[model samples]
Every structure is written in structure tokens, then in C-alpha cells.
Target: MIQPLDSVIVHTLTRVITPVIQLFALYVLIHGHDSPGGGFQAGTLFAASVILPIIAFGIQGSLSVLERRAIILGGIGILLFAGIGLLPLILGGEFLNYGKLPIPGMEASARRHWGILGIEIGVTITVAATAVSIYYSLRERGEGEEK
Candidate 1:
């Protein structure tokens, strides 16, 4: 059995810091287009936020938060990315040609902006799910061997 920490300071600090980490991850995700960060970086940070509970509480606790939905999340991401690409084709343009998107109120550049944002959201989901899946797989393997 995995032993949790007994220190009050450790528990308290973890509780306080985890939300801040998650909020910062959101900030990174939102501001990525205008700044140095992007989907990959934000996803990693988001995964790190998920990981903090694992470190503090254990895999079972973290699994409650993550569930078994990692693969589903990845699939959704793939669909989002591919669907956006295919949309342009269906609208009589080349793949991922954001200019061909038919939003009535938006110019071509605005359409492109929304398209990029959609792509980034897809990438973020894929990366975060992949990272969490890997972490859970490794932890499960390690636990299995200890028995």
C-alpha cells in the first residue's frame, strides 16, 4: 500500500498551490496566441496540476479526478483537429483552409484566428490526456510489481 504524507504543512501547501497552478495553466492556454506559450506548454502545465494530487494523495485519489477518460479525451481531440481540417474540404477548399470557413460576421483573418484557437484547444486536450495516461500506466506498473 502507498503511504500518504502525515505532515500538515505538506498537505496544506499542496492544497493551496494546486489551484494556482491550474489557474496559471488556464492563463497560458488563453494567452498562448499572443505570447510565447501555446498548446503544448499549457497542456504540460495543466497535466502538472493534475499530477500534484497524485503526488500528494496517490493514484487512486488522482484517478477519481482523471477517471478512465484519457483515451476518450484523446479521441475527442483528434476529432476536433481532423473535423476542422475536413470542414474546409467539405466547403470547397483545401484542407485546413480557415479562410473558407463561413462565419457570417467574421472576415478571413478572424476566421483564421478562430480556426487556430480550435486547433490549439484540440492539441491541448490530446497532449494533456496523453501525459496523464502515461503517468497512470507507469504508476500502475510500478504498483503491480510491488505485490
Candidate 2:
């Protein structure tokens, strides 16, 4: 629920820019470990990704597009990270120790790198989506909440 004042500036820009931002965030998330970016950076990018649409289309519409499944996304992310960590424990190694991932024919170093990457990806998605939701909620002033 955008106030008339918010409609003038934020809404217009977000209406056109959110999709592009989301795409960029995915690119960053996928390329994170190899490039200069990682989970934290990519997460912020994703947060910004949703902001435009939220500002433009209003909170409800934005939720229809992305926000509605925020908790589900976060759950999956947690599972991914936890699964990776559990693999090590099952293999008799320390937590987050990917030497236990059981990837056949992969070198130890390579396995470790891959594990870190998977964990980072999960972190990025959960954190970014959460941030976006919070930002939208805070921004949606004058929407007239019910008692």
C-alpha cells in the first residue's frame, strides 16, 4: 500500500527495475566463489533486487511475485547448508568438513571448494530474501494496517 507521495518516485523506478536486479543477483550468487563476490555480497544484491518491484508494484504484488515464499526459500537454504555439514559428520569428520561429501573421483581440495560454494549459495538466498521482506515491510508506511 503505497501512499500517494511514495507513488511519485519509488514506485515508478521499482516498477521497471526489479526483474533486472533479480537477474543480476542470481548471476552474482552463482558466480560467487569463483568471482570477487560471495554469499553476503550476493544476498545484499538480491535484497536490492526485490526493493524496486516492492516500491513500484506495492507490497502485496511484490509478495505475489517473490515475497510469499520467503520462509520456504529460507528453509531450503538452511537444509542445503545443514546437509552439507551433516555429510562430514556422517563420514566421521568435523562439521562443515566437506572431505566427507562422498563425491567419487573428486580431489579433496575440489570437494572442499564445492562444499563451501553450496553453503554460500544457501546463505545468500535466505539472507537476501529475508532482508528484502523486512525492507518492504518497513517501507510500506501509510498502508493502513488493521487492528
Candidate 3:
């Protein structure tokens, strides 16, 4: 995405605003277990935090931080889910059976939370990328149709 306007003022504001969004994302991720917010919300917020720069400073600036990392992040999230799901099998329960996570301090609820966090991150990445991809595609298609 490209900024509609280029100005030093917008750049300065963007510098100030991006960090706040990032901190909120972290809050959502950590406090998610007992609250209404969680990884999905946080991940998209994270993506949006990055995307805002794209909208304000253009793609070149957005790439400096967010880059093409969403794809890799999605993969890592999947791996995390798989590892958590396998924990049950390692401890003699069936796949995805959370109670067997094999730690005394952690309960199945924690497992559920951990496993869900991974899934949510994966969901967020795919969703955020897909949203941007669709917008770009449709915009391009619309332009082509005008010819």
C-alpha cells in the first residue's frame, strides 16, 4: 500500500504511533487466557500495526520492519500447534488430548491456551495476508477492467 500523501508530519506521527499498537498486541497475547482477547486479535493488531506504516510511509518503509515475514510466522505457528498436539501422544494420550502435556505446573487448560495461541497466530497471519492480497488483487483487477 502507498500513502496518499507524503509529508514529514505524517512520518513523524507514524513513528510515535506504531509502538503503542505493538505494546497492545503483547498485552493481548499474554493476558488472553483469562480474557476476551488473545493471539488472533493480537496477531492482526500486530499486522495492522505494521500495515499502518505501509499506508502512511509506503511499501518501502513497511518492508523495513514487517517485510515478508507473515508467511514465515504462519509456518512457525503451525509448527507450534503440532508440537503441542504431539505432547499428548508422547505422554500416552491421543493426538490433541491436552491433559497429558507432561508438566506439573501446567494444566490442560494451559495446554488449551498454548495450543489455541498457535492456531490463532496461524489464523491471524493467513487472514491478514489474505486480506491485503485480496485488496491488491481486486484493485489491480479493477484497474485492468477500466482499460
Best model number under TM-score: 1
Q: Compute the lDDT of residue 147 as modeled in candidate 2.
A: 17
Q: Best candidate, lDDT-wise? A: 1
Kindly list the per-residue Cα lDDT of model 1 for residues 42-120, writing each as its tens digit: 8888788887777777775576546456867988988998998889999999999988877789899999998888888
Q: Candidate 2: what lDDT?
A: 0.75
* Tens digits of per-residue lDDT for model 3, 1-147: 223458888888888989998888778877786687876787777767766776676555645323444455556666666777887898899987766776678777876666666556655565555444444444345545746
On TM-score, the stronger of 1 and 2 is 1
Ranking of all candidate structures by their TM-score, best first:
1, 2, 3
Clashing pairs in 3: none
> In candidate 1, how many Å is residue 16 off?
1.3
Candidate achieving higher lDDT, 1 or 3: 1
**Model 2 TM:** 0.77
What are the TM-scores, per candidate, against the unseen true structure? 0.91, 0.77, 0.70
> Over the stretch 1-147, how does candidate 2's per-residue lDDT look in tens digits?
453334557666665677777787777877876778788788888887766565555655566545645757777878888988998998899999997788899998999888988899889977887886677556654465531
Show where candidate 2 strays beyond 4 Å.
4-16, 65-69, 139-142
Task: Rate residue 4 of model 3 by lDDT.
Answer: 45
**Angstrom error at residue 97, model 1:** 1.2
